[model samples]
Target chain A: EDKVVQSPLSLVVHEGDTVTLNCSYEVTNFRSLLWYKQEKKAPTFLFMLTSSGIEKKSGRLSSILDKKELFSILNITATQTGDSAVYLCAVRGGTSYDKVIFGPGTSLSVIP
Target chain B: SAVISQKPSRDICQRGTSLTIQCQVDSQVTMMFWYRQQPGQSLTLIATANQGSEATYESGFVIDKFPISRPNLTFSTLTVSNMSPEDSSIYLCSVEPRVGDTQYFGPGTRLTVL
Candidate 1:
């Protein structure tokens, strides 16, 4: 079975603290890894990492994938209360067609 | 980037009822997907709806339980049949505009079964 696991199911941090969320997946075919932020309703796209070693960043958020280890990490710097949300990791892979599997997600609460 | 919208943003229904959720994308997309997210659980792909073809459902999800319709590239609908308390969840619709592209999600419909 294709599975994606996330660490620290829930986390609470004070404002300005830096946080790192982990996602590891085991699938038959590895295509790409994606990170999303779910606030209340749907998840918003954050980053998609397909290559190893290289990092994708946007303002205070960044992410990287390690194909050799079958894992990925999302880093948030100088986090604020607005950063509180459920961070989700998804992997897309399959031999015939695109198949996406999602992790349980890491819920982070940034308190001011 | 694509803007997706889902309607009946939230709804409450009694057991044994059915509800159809609509997903509309601003631009033409190649593939649309339906997913279910139970409270405190991860998202599960229900099926993949492509225009001009029957939807392909994932294992454990059958077409009878969740019927999908894709009449065009930008529109799709998912109808949940025989609702129960256990069926209460957030139904999300996502689209992959192109192959190898990041999927974008609609706002989602929150269904509460009483």
Candidate 2:
């Protein structure tokens, strides 16, 4: 069974604070790892990490994958109230058409 | 990235009733996925709807409970049968383009069974 686990199930931080969310997974054949931000309805895509040590960044949010450790981390620099949402991590494995398994997710609250 | 549109954004249904949610993608996609998200919970894969085959269901999910139909490459439907309060959830449809593993999601349908 492919399973993904996220750490720091929930967190509360004031604006301008930085936070790091962790996600680790165990799968039969790992293809890629993806991150999403969910506010109320649908989850929007954030980043997809396929190679280790290489980081993908967009504005204040960045993520890196460590294939050897089978883990990944999402870092938010100078968080804002808008960043308060559930961060989800999912892993795609088995085959190219395999289903994605998601982590429980980290609930982040950025207070103003 | 593909754009997905899910119909019946939300609905409140009575117990034992069934609801069918529709998903339409702007572009043709090889694989479309359906997922269930309970309140304050992670998204769970319900099934993978392929263009010409029966949807492949995940563990803990059955075809009878969640029947899916993929008539084409860009459209699919998921029906939640015999609903109960416990069946209340937000159902989302996702599409993967070109098999790179990045998935784009539809806005989702919020179903509340009372």
Candidate 3:
């Protein structure tokens, strides 16, 4: 069975803190990994990583995937109170590699 | 990125009632997906709707409980039948503009069963 696992299920950090969220997966075939942030009812897209070592960055958020290790990491620097939300990591992999399996997520609470 | 929208942003319904959520995309998409997220939980695939074929449901989901319809490339609907308190969740619709592309999500419909 394909599964995605995330570490430190929940985190509470002060303002301007840097947090690293981890995601590991076990699947039949490795494809792409994605990150999303959910504040309310909707989950906003964050980043999609398909290569190893190379990082994708957007403002204060960055992510990288390690296919050999079958894991990915999302880093958030200088996090503000507005950044308080659940960070989700998902992978698209399986026999056909079409379905996206999501991790339990890391809930970050940023205190100002 | 494709713009997606869902109707009935939030609703509180009685147990045993049913709700139909609609999803609309700005552009044509080959595959649309439906997901359910329980409170404090991650998103779970409910089904996948294609324009010209019947929706394919994921494991632990049945068509009778969650019927989906994809009338065109840009629109789809998911109906949740016989609601219960356990059925309370946020229903999200997502679309992949092309095959093997990133999936974009809708704002989601929050349902509460009382």
Candidate 4:
């Protein structure tokens, strides 16, 4: 079965703290890894990593994938209360249909 | 990224009833996916809807329980038949405009079964 696991199911940090969320997956025919930020309703797209050793960054949020290790990490530098949300990691794979499997998610609480 | 919208943002229905959710995309998409997220749980894909064909359901999900229709490349619908309290969840519609593109999500339909 395709599985995506995340570490530290929940985390609490004050403003300006840097946090790192981890995502590891085991699937057949790995293609791409994606990260999303879910606030209240729907999840918003953050980054998609398809290659190893290369990092994708956006302002305070950055992410990188390590295909060799079968994992990815999302880093948030100088976080704020607005960053409090559920961070979700998903992997798309499968040679026949390309199914996307999602992790349980990391609930972040950035206190002001 | 594509813009997607769902009808009846939320609904509260009685048990044994059924609700059909609509998803509309601004641009033509080849594939549309339906997902169910239970309270505080991860997203579970219900099925993949492709135009001109029947939807392919995921494991544990059947067509009788969750029937889907993709009339065209830009619109689709999912009907949750015979709802129960356990069926209460947030149903989201997503689409990837093109291959290798990020899948964008709709606001989602919040359904609560009594």
Runs off by more than 4 Å, candidate 1:
none
lDDT of 3: 0.92
- List, residue by residue over B1-114, the lDDT tens digit for candidate 2: 988999999999999999999999998998899999998789988998978889999879999999999999989999999999999999999999877668999999999999
Residues B1-114 of candidate 3: C-alpha lDDT, one tens digit per residue: 899999999999999999999999999998899999998889999999977788999989999999999999999999999999999999999988877778889999999999
Name the lDDT of candidate 1.
Answer: 0.94
What is the C-alpha RMSD, rounded to one decimal, of candidate 1?
Answer: 1.0
What TM-score does each model's chain B reach against the true chain B? 0.98, 0.98, 0.98, 0.98
Residue A28 lDDT in candidate 2: 70
Minimum summed lDDT over a 10-residue window in model 3 chain A is located at: A92-101
RMSD of each: 1.0, 1.4, 0.9, 0.9
Chain A vs. true chain A, TM-score per model, equals: 0.97, 0.96, 0.96, 0.97
**What DockQ do the predictions score, one after another?**
0.93, 0.85, 0.85, 0.86
Each candidate's fnat: 0.87, 0.80, 0.77, 0.73
The TM-score obtained by model 1 is 0.98
**Model 3 stretches with alpha carbons more than 4 Å out:** none
lDDT per residue (tens digit) for residues B1-114 in model 4: 888999989999999999999999999997799999999999999999989899999889999999999999999999999999999999999998886578899999999999
Model 4 regions more than 4 Å off: none
lDDT of each: 0.94, 0.93, 0.92, 0.95
